[model samples]
Target chain A: MNLLLLSPDDLRADGSAVVEDRRLQHMLQVQRVEPGQQLRAGLLGGLMGQATVQQLDSHQAHLTLLLDQPPPAKLPLTLVLALPRPKMLKRTLQTIAAMGVQRLVLVNSFRVEKSFWQTPWLQEDSIREQLLLGLEQACDTVLPEVILEKRFKPFVEDRLPALAAANLKLVAHPGEHPECPRALGEQPLTLAIGPEGGWIPYEVELLRKADFAPVQLGPRILRVETAVPALIARLY
Target chain B: MNLLLLSPDDLRADGSAVVEDRRLQHMLQVQRVEPGQQLRAGLLGGLMGQATVQQLDSHQAHLTLLLDQPPPAKLPLTLVLALPRPKMLKRTLQTIAAMGVQRLVLVNSFRVEKSFWQTPWLQEDSIREQLLLGLEQACDTVLPEVILEKRFKPFVEDRLPALAAANLKLVAHPGEHPECPRALGEQPLTLAIGPEGGWIPYEVELLRKADFAPVQLGPRILRVETAVPALIARLY
Candidate 1:
């Protein structure tokens, strides 16, 4: 982990923290941290700074934190993604968090399998765990908000108008469309990416009607995990 | 598999072919092919077109090939990457191939663990398997050329200068460098990405001497897998 993340509960009143969970194990093993050594650290949903190892052992690591710096700015973007399968969902969650996405809407598309909705990875704790891993990877403290929309038509027709209004609404589709824009200069954007086989004609039309301009990334179709970063880099 | 890839051995002199492998199983189970069904197919290192199913059974599928169209144009880019861990290596290979990277050099770096070079994933057959999967994912027929550089300094000093000559040689480092360029319309580029912790100062200097201009991707640190696509999308 690039950053050692500590929750609010880990902090004592004196600003000292004792970590005894997986973070402790990671510090001891992967990081090979020792007493008196300082490492980059951040509090969950709070500030980021450094922590000095006061005491260390196999069971726990006592640290004195100096959380003075604000977390990195999140991307001014909202991602609307067709819920991927369970296996891909886990990695995509981490990827989204690491890439500084501010908001995410996991929406349903015609091609999304009904069984995908039943995955335990969608549980709050599971999602939080993956997001934490991503935050640690990117050394960021802020968590992105994730919204689930199981119904396609209602979400797009009823909610997406206001949700996408005033933003550069884009839907990444593969066809005869303009290339995805570049260097958009901090404009707020809402980008929708479809499932593996892609959004059906009806879904695309609904998105189009919702004001999402269809954009292409040339001919080579990339997986959602690959496409997310590519699109984000291009737009931002 | 988007495009069923056929090798030379799979084709018959009569322009028909029989396949009894994983591709056949995918055609039978995932694609659910029947007689007279046409699917997108491509010949390895050759043309891409349609394959009409002439016969099908549990053991094999026979098809008549009409290879005509050329594969998608490859990105005019060569990637120089520090060897990632085995798991990341597998995904990175697929990502490189899917994104149409024409050439790759997996090189050593100060932060790269020595064991990474020992991974079975570095084996020729294993690497080819992952590349094929990437090609299949992107529906492309051409395979990327992969080069392994176990020693860092020798390759960068003696060879990389000539290799990166005349191309836009860039080394992606997170620092006070200019942002990576965008949409340089078909200009060839050679991009170097370091390991997780990044290239040490000496290595960066060596690369600088070799004429690789340092570039940054903002403050947020991305995993190599994420960075590859992000950089490629931005450059091309």
Candidate 2:
């Protein structure tokens, strides 16, 4: 873990906290923390700074926090993705979070298998845990917000337009379309990426009607896990 | 698999072949093959075309091939990476092959764990299997070349210079460096990305002395799997 994330519950009025969970285990084993050592640390949903390790053991580590620096900037974009298979969802969550995505909307797509929705990885706590891992990996303090849309049509027709208003809307679909644009600098954007089979014709038409331009990478199709980072890096 | 890859042994002089392995299983169970079915197929390191299924069964698939089309183009770049852990190595191999990288050099570094050199995934057969899977995933037929450098100084000082000659030599490192360049369409390039813990100071200096300009991908430290695709996408 690059940054030790401290939840509000773990902090006191005097800015001291006791860590005894997985974070503690990571600090002890992976980081090999020592007493009097200062570690890069941040408060979840808050600022980041250094933490002085006061005590260490198998049980817990006593720490003193001084969260003075603001967290790194997030991308001015909202990602609308097809719910991936459970295993991919875990890593993708961490990938997007580490890339500094501010928001994600996991919407249903025709190609998304119905069984994917039943995965426990979609649970709020489970999602939070993965996002936390991403934050720690990136050494960022902010947790990206996530919204779920199990029903595709209603979410697209009723809610998406308003949510994506004023943003450059895009859908990463394969076939005869312009290449996905590059280095869009500061433009606010909302990009929808499809499933392994890609968006069905009807779904693409619906998104097009909603003003999302279709973009292509190339003749070769990339797995979603690889595609997300590629698209993100190219865009910004 | 997106494209069914056929080895030379799987083909005959009459251009008819029998597939009885995992590919057959994928055709039967996943693709749900039927008699007289036409499927996308490619010869290993050769042309891609369509295969007509002549017989369907629980054991083998009898097919008629008319291979004509050439495979997709590869990137005009050579990737030099620090050998990752075995698991990441396997996945990274597939990813690079899928992304159309034609050559890769895996070198040792100070930060790389010693035991990573002993991974079974480094074996030629295992590496080829992963690369083939990647080619199948991207509907490309050609496999990328892999070069292993177990000793650091000899390879970087003695071999990398000639291997990377006439290419735009660059290294992906953290800390004060220019942001990586984008879209150098047909210009041959060579890029070196470090390991998980990053290149130590001495390693970076040696690379710099060898004429690889350092490039940064902002502040976030993405995992190597995420970084490879991101760097490839941004660079090309």
Candidate 3:
């Protein structure tokens, strides 16, 4: 883990801290951290800091935390993806976290199989594990907000507009006019990618009306997992 | 499987065939083949064809073969990658095959752990299995040639010039001038991507001198697996 993420409840007074259990095992075994060395640590939804080792044991580690500043601001991007297979969903979340995305909305698509919604990875704890992997890779601590929407119409008609307001919104679809822009700089954006068979015509039209401009990633059809990296690389 | 790949020895003079064993299991059980159904099939290192089911039994399936024209030419691209971890190496090879790449040269990089080179995935037969997966995905049978260069200095100094002749060579590096092109049409191109932590400064400079343009995919640092898809999406 790049930054050991801890909740505010886990902190003790006097800037002294104790880390035990899984996170501690990861630090001691996977990272092979040594006593007298410093490691990056942070609050789950708060600022990051450097922690100096005070004591080390097989079961726990005590450290002195030097909290100073909050983590870097997240990308002004919110992604709305048609839920893919469970394996892919995990990887996409990690990738999104690594890219500094802080909000995700998973929705159902016509091409999405009903069976996919039953995957265990969609459970809150499972989802959080994948996000943590991404945060560690990016050296950040803040966990992104994740929401699940089963009905497409209600989300598009009732909720999407509020999110799209004041942001450049783009939806990735094949065969659209005016290619997707190459860079967005510091501006916030909301990008939507459809399921394997792509957004159905009606869905695309609704998204377009809701201010989502259609974009393409070229002619060859890419798998959904591959498409995630391809779109994020271009948009971010 | 998009294409059923077969060896040359499996072809019959009468153009009738019997497919048994692992492939038979996949066709009969996984794909649920039925009489009169047609599937895309190809001869390894040869032409692609259409196969029609004539009969089926518990052990084997009988087919009528109609060999047709060769597949469309592969993209004229050469990939130079730092040898990835064994698990990732397997998938990467499969992706390369599916995309119809013609050549791959695995090189040494600072961030590439020496242990990675010793992976069993590099065994000839294992590598072929990964390539077959790619071929099946693309409905094509042509296999990309694989090369391994353990020594960095000798290969870069001697072989790189001939490899880059008459081709656009680009290196996928972060924080570089002139970001990776979004599209390059059908030009013969050479693309390079680094290992987990990326190539050291000297390695990147060596590639630049060999006429490889250094490029970035914006500010987000993508994992090598993700970067491969992004690079291919931009190029092919």
Candidate 4:
């Protein structure tokens, strides 16, 4: 874990904190942290800081908090992606969070298999687990908000206007000339990546009419998870 | 697996083929192929074709090859990347291969610690393993060539000229202006990605002087593995 994340409720009234969860075990076993050792730490939804280990036992550990800096900056880009396969979904969330994306909108597309929606990974806790892994990699604590949109049209027509109101919008599709701009100026961006087989023509057109320019990532098609990180990197 | 890849030596004198390795296991277990099933197949350094499942046993499978359509088109790009951590290195090879990258030039960089070079994953077999994974994903048969350049300067100055001769060269670094263009016309591409902390200014300048156009993928910095897919998607 890059940053040891704790919840605010986990802090004791006396200002000391006890960590008895799996994270504590990871600290003790994987990191091999000992008493008095300093660790980079954070409180979920709280400040990022240094923590000094004060006590350790088989089951729990205590530490003193000292928030030193502000939380890591959130990526200015918002990603709206078609749901990927469950295995890819886990890695995608971790990567998105690690890159500090503030929001992710998982939308349904024609190419998305119906069976994919049934995946247990779509569960709330499962989603959070992946996000936490990303945060750990980046040593950040804030979790990005995730929204699920089962229907494309209603969400696009009803909510996307507001979402795109303050952002530069782009959709990733193949065969569009000149493609999307690599460096979006200072404006916030809302970028869309399609499913494995990619968006149908009508879907691409809808997004385009909604102000999302259809852009190509060259000739080679990439898998959804790989494409997400690639798009995020270029647009952020 | 994308396409079943067989080495030239795997071909028997009678022109029938036997596959008894992990590829065979993947075909039997994951693909669940039975006799008479037709699947895409390719030779490692030869042709791609349709294969009729002739027979299957617990340990091996037999196939009758019918060379038809050629192998899928490869990415018209060459990747020059600083060697990543061993884990990332494995994924990078797999991802690049899956994307149909033709060649990989793994180089040294400032942020790339010296110890990363010592990883057993740098061994040929391990690297080939990852490439096969990528090929399986794309259903392509050709394996990309992985070249290592321990010293950056000589390789950049000597070898790059010949490689960049017919391609547009791009080096991914943060802070380049007007940002990078998303796609160049259908010429071959030579793209470079930096180490985790990025290429030092000197390295960036040297690359530029060596005819690589320095490009930025927006403001948020990305990990090397993330950058690879992102740049590939943008360029290819």
Candidate 5:
């Protein structure tokens, strides 16, 4: 982990924090941190700075906090993605969070297997852990919020309109369409990417009704894990 | 698998092809092919077309090839990447191949763990298998050639010059480098990406001597798997 992320509960009243659990394991095994060493650390949803290691053991490490630097700015984006398979979904969570995407809406698509919706990885804690890993990897502090919409048509018709209001709405589909825009001056955008076999025409039409302009990333198809970052990087 | 890639050995004198092994498993289990069905197919490193399933059994599938369309064009790029951990390397191979990067060089970096150089994933058959999966995913026929340079200084100093000759050479380093270029009109280019913690100053200097201008992908540090496609997409 690039950043040592601490929850509020980890903080003591004396401006010190005690880190345990997986972070502690990483410190002991991966980092081999020393008592006097300072780690680039951040509080969850808060500031980022350094934490000087005060004491260490198998159980926990005591760290003094000095968070002052603001976290990096999140993208002005709300990604509306088809729920990928469980394996890809895990990586996509981390990928999106690392890229500074702050809002995500996972929706159903025709090609998305019904079995995908039943994965335990969609659990709240499981999702947060993956996002935390992304935040830690990128040295960011704030967590990206995730929303689930198991029903496609209702979410597109009832909910997506307001969520996409006053933003550039786009759906990243393959085939003949305009090239995915580059560095569009950091405008707030809601981009929907489809599943493996792509969104059927009816689904694309539904997204179109929500004012999402269809876009393409050329003729070559990419896996969702690869495409997410590619699309984000090209945008801004 | 999107494309059933046939090696020359699989071809019969009568223009029929026999596929068995893992591709057969995928065809039977996932695709559920019938006796007279057509699927997109391609020959390894050659043209792409369709395969009509002539017969199917648990052991093999006999297909008739009708190759007319050429595979999609490869990018005018050569990517030099630091050897990632084995798990990431597997995905990176598939990703680069899928994105039409026909040439890749995996080299050493100071930050790269020594054990990464020893991974079985770097073996010829293993690498080819991953690249084939990528080609199948993207509906392409060409396989990317992968070269290994275990020594850092020698490859960058001795070999990289010729490899990067007359191409737009770039190194995707983090920090105060110029922003990465976009859509340079398909000129031949060479890009080097570092391992997890990024390249040290010495390595960057050696690359600089070889005419590799340093470039940045903004502030967020992405995993290597994410960054590869990101860089490729933006460059093209």
Candidate 6:
């Protein structure tokens, strides 16, 4: 873990914390941190700073925290993605979170298998766990909000237009389309990416009506995981 | 599989081919191809086009080849990457290939675990298999060339300089450095990315001596998998 993320419950009134869970184990084993050493840490939904390890043992690691610095700024983007397969969903969650995406809408497309919705990885706790890993990887504290939309039409027709009203709305599709814009300088954006087979023409039409301009990266197609970072980097 | 990749042995003198492997299974189950149906296909290291399914069954699928179109252009770049752990290595290989990176050098660094060098994923056949999957995903016919460097100092001091000579040489380091360049259209580039813990000062110094300019993505640290696409997108 790049940064140890602690929940409010883990902190004491005196600005100290005792980590006895996976974080402690990871610090002891993977990081090989010893008592009296300082490590970077952050509070979930709070600030980030350094923590001095006071006492270390097999049971727990007592730390005195100095949380003074604010977390890194999130990207000014709301990502609308067609829910990927279960295995990909887990990694994409971590990727999007690590890349500083603040909001995500996992919507359905015709090509998305109904079975994908039933995956255990979509459970609240499972999703949070993946997001936490991403936060730790990126050394950030703020968690991105995730919204699920099982039906495509209602979400796009009723909600997407308003959600994307003031933002640069884009749908990343491989076709005869303009290249995705670069370094748009912090404008709020909403980008839609499709399932493995890509958005059907009907879905594309619906999205187009919702104001998402179709854009292409190049002729070569990329997987959802790869596409997310590529689009984010190019846009901002 | 988006494109069925065929080896020379799979072709017949009569301009036909028989698929009796995973491609056949994918065609039978995933694609559900029938006689007289056409499917996108590509020859390994060759052109891409459509194939007409002349005969189909569980045992095999016979096709008439009509190859014409050229594969997508590869990035005019050579990537120098610290060998990641096995799982990440597998995914990264697929990603680089799909993103049209044609030349890659997997090198050793201080933080790269010794066991990473021994992974079966690094074997020629295993690497080829992953690259093929990536080519299939991207619908391209060309396979990327992968080079392995087991020793750190020798490779960097001896070979990397010449390999990166006359190219825009960049080393991605997470620290105070210039932001990575953008849209340097079609310039040949050689980029070096480090292991999870990042390149040590010594390594960075050696790379600097070799004439690589250090570049940073941002404050947020990204996993190697995420960084590859992000860097490629920004650079291209």
lDDT values, one for every candidate: 0.93, 0.93, 0.81, 0.82, 0.93, 0.93
DockQ, per-model, please? 0.86, 0.88, 0.33, 0.29, 0.79, 0.89
Better of 4 and 6 by TM-score: 6
Candidate 2 matches the true fold with a TM-score of 0.99
Model 2 chain A worst lDDT run, 10 consecutive residues? A8-17
Relative to the real complex, the DockQ score for model 5 comes to 0.79
Segments of candidate 2 deviating more than 4 angstroms = none
Off by over 4 Å in 6: none
Error of 2 at B195 (Å): 0.8
- What TM-score results for chain B in every one of the models? 0.98, 0.98, 0.95, 0.92, 0.98, 0.98
Instruction: Give per-residue CA lDDT, model 4, range A109-206, as digits (tens).
Output: 99898888999999999999988877876777889999999999888889988987868888888784566676564678898888877889888888
Could you give candidate 6's per-residue lDDT for residues A1-236 as a string of tens digits? 99999999988889899899999989989999988999999999999999999999999899999999999999989999999999999999999899899899999999999999999999999999999999999999999999999999999999988888899899999999999999987799999999998999999999999888999998887889989999999999
Docking class of 3: acceptable
Whole-model lDDT, model 1: 0.93
Q: Which tens-of-lDDT digit does each residue in A1-236 have in candidate 1?
A: 99999999999998899999999999988899989999999999999999999999999899999889999899899999999999889889998999899999999999999999999999999999999999999999999999999999999999998988899999999999999999887899999999998999999999999999999998887998898889988888
Name the TM-score of candidate 3: 0.81
TM-score of each: 0.98, 0.99, 0.81, 0.69, 0.98, 0.99
Which residues of candidate 4, in runs, are more than 4 Å off? B1-90, B99-126, B132-142, B147-236
What's the residue-level lDDT of B138 in candidate 6?
88
In candidate 6 the C-alpha lDDT for residue B14 amounts to 92
Give the alpha carbon lDDT tens digit for every residue of B48-93 in model 2.
Answer: 9999999979998999998899999999889999999898998899
Give a tens-digit lDDT track for model 5, residues B51-160.
99999899989999999999999998899999999999999999999999969999999999999988889889999999999999988988888899999999999999
